[model samples]
Target: MTYSLSDFGSYWAGGEVLCVTEGAPREIAFTRDARFTYDPRGDFAVNAAYVQYFVPAQAVDAPPVLLVHGGGMAGSCWETTPDGRPGWLHRLLDAGRVVHVVDLPERGRAGFAPGHLPGEPILRSMQEAWTLFRFGPAEGFADRTPFAHQQFPVDALEAFARRFVPRWQGTAHLHLAAFLAVLDRTGPALVICHSQGSETAFDAVATNPNRITGLIALEPSAFPDDPAALETCPLVIVQGDHLDSADHWRTRADRWATLADELPDARLIDTAHEVASGGSHMLMMDRHSDQVLEATLGHVRV
Candidate 1:
């Protein structure tokens, strides 16, 4: 299904902008024979990070909410559900938020092309998502039924699978560069990022704490290099369920929990413990997304 990004919110007006970034030249080896043969275009290349604004009919006295998606995903991740239902973008806008959904560099509508990015695209296999997202029994992904309280649109799993973007690994620097560009144009915003996207949000806050008023990380997989700097910004860490079993996320969650304790304005919101229905890693797309949305909005309002 095709979606017009401008119609993301229940707002009076909205628009889209392509944020460009100029950076220092970097060496690139195109082939085995070519050494440090960089593109002659200099540093000013059009980044793929697209930003959209949704202005509400009644303006709320709050910073706009900037929605950033996780790895292997794009700005479309927050636009709609696999089952063709309203998504977080709509929910936030209805709640009186000026929303900005971003397509990070090399992902989504952010002009992703082969050789444009340094690395190969990271494609998520069905099994990888099934196991990593904690949809069902990890042992037998296809055989086991999804959690009875699953918030994800499991019946329309195929649609969800198709939402995955052609994302590149080891491009956090590039993503951050473009993210900073968006932040510059939007002024202070409440950065709501998920998983890998959290890295850019965290770094953006540290880079310039004044640019971001608040930060909400949903199942953050990456962390801040300097927690001391991040502590200045109001931060909310949302950890989804089933993390205790996954070693990869288990340690990361624990580390962030510890880091949160050290920060004055930082707090961790464990969705697993917040609601009886609980939530998976992709809580925003889960069945109880509304509940999680309210939880996040609470922090943003603070």
Candidate 2:
């Protein structure tokens, strides 16, 4: 109840803030299908611009795994699949491991900024406008009993990174220049964030620790109050014990397991009993998401 950045851009441009271009795509298909496209007539993009991949079909030379979704859901939640086959982006592309999926910054196809409000739409009990257009827009703000918590007025994420980070300045320097241009074009690799994009993939590997060689934070929501950029990498804190009884997600997983116990190369794999039956923070796309992708490829292949 404290919105004020032009009243949160006029209540996200007066449509009660709901922006979603398109979703539900990954109809199960892997073994290579990349597409990180962009510039969809740019005006702060968002007409489902692009960001989908599913590489796998073995053939090593690993080092390139950036899934990073979670928060309403997109990038088809790592190309969701279970009984139908090929999920976890084809198990990190069979294990050859070179997968990068990102549809962050407000849901998939990533395009929304012409008077805003492309997602975060809610309305469950107001006699249901046909169940809010058949629960579209990412299941209509993911039915939190008719959506109640919407945000995006921290200067509209710095006016959406000065219209998609190309030379934009301010909004924490365009989120540190889009985290150094996605780790200088996807660095050393291995980062698998879910839930709040694990706080921008742990601040893009803690502000570029030589472009990450490891990290698998599945349920992270990035509650930074100077966690030393997640105590400087090598993390593995997966959570789901019912979001650990939500006292601010167990105080940010006990402050990231107390900064991974003073960082002896940090690690905290609390799967919460393999996601105790109902891990619905989209559970990485449910059915225990291959046991959270085999515990995130056995800790990103050691």
Candidate 3:
């Protein structure tokens, strides 16, 4: 079920608007006032959804920090708590940093009407569908429980692939543009990206050059390409030792160091050992969140 640009326009014209919520499990807040748009030429043109959280800083002049989540999860994942308490959102807010989190298009409560692209298969599950249709994390990496239970139509996949995937150099640019748009209106800010979200932060720093003050990347995925592109910004890559072996951390640290060595402006702080007690990939939300936060705060400078 391939869709042309016109097909997407027609779909968007009749598509139902839905209110998506973003926050941690402790406090699930709805985007009471949210807007949606489709841009075929832009990132995913399926159109990414933006969710704004206003964190009033004690000092009116504090710069904001854009928190971006990785694939499969929305901004809410950052705040979700096993015991139902405010997650990192409150932590950042408490520390005097204004935070803005977003739900990139196609995921979360964002939806597409049926018959939009009829020829594609109607997926039995959203997770399976996402793995089959979208780029980023492979199927093996998916957390089975979530992927197995959610369902989505294949045309939605077509819309994502046809419109969104082609324009995206990687997941990083989609997020970078979203943050940049916010920064244009707000002001220069720090970028706190988790998992694959770090890719976007790296792209933003590389492309914009000094627009973002610092980046705190939690369990950043592997990027073997040009590490030099990421050398321009002060980056703190946090790796959970429990997720991978010492060799994995060593290799990643060496790569980051190599990249930093080339740029001179870049600095790498490998926190694998620091987060060794944390279970796995989702370290930012794990038991060691305080450590992660402290390490992140130490590097970010604000």
Best by lDDT: 1
What is candidate 2's CA lDDT for residue 268?
70
Error of 1 at 198 (Å): 0.7
Per-residue lDDT over 163-276 for candidate 2, one digit per residue giving the tens place of the 0 to 100 score: 222111122232334434555665577777765566666666666766877787765666444566655467776654444333665677687787677666676766545434
- The Cα RMSD of model 1 versus the native structure comes to 7.5
- In the range 80-153, model 3's lDDT, one tens digit per residue, is 44334456766776666677765554434333222222243222344443443221234433443222212212
- Candidate 2 regions with alpha-carbon error over 4 angstroms: 1-49, 57-66, 69-94, 98-100, 105-109, 118-191, 198-219, 222-250, 253-296, 299-302
Better of 2 and 3 by TM-score: 3
Better of 1 and 3 by lDDT: 1
Sequence-dependent TM-score of model 1: 0.83
Ten-residue stretch with the least lDDT total in model 2: 6-15
For model 1, state the Cα shift of residue 160 in Å. 0.5
Better of 1 and 3 by TM-score: 1
lDDT for 288 (candidate 1) = 77
Candidate 1 ranges beyond 4 A from true positions: 1-44
Candidate 1: tens digits of C-alpha lDDT, residues 1-302: 12223334321112233333544456887887887835444333455477767776755678888899998988888988778878898887776777888888777666665645576777897778887887766665676477656666667777889988777778888788888878777788888899999999988988888999888898888888888888678888887776655788779888879988999988888877785354778888887787888876777653
TM-score of each: 0.83, 0.26, 0.59
lDDT of 2 at 125: 38
Greater-lDDT candidate between 1 and 2? 1
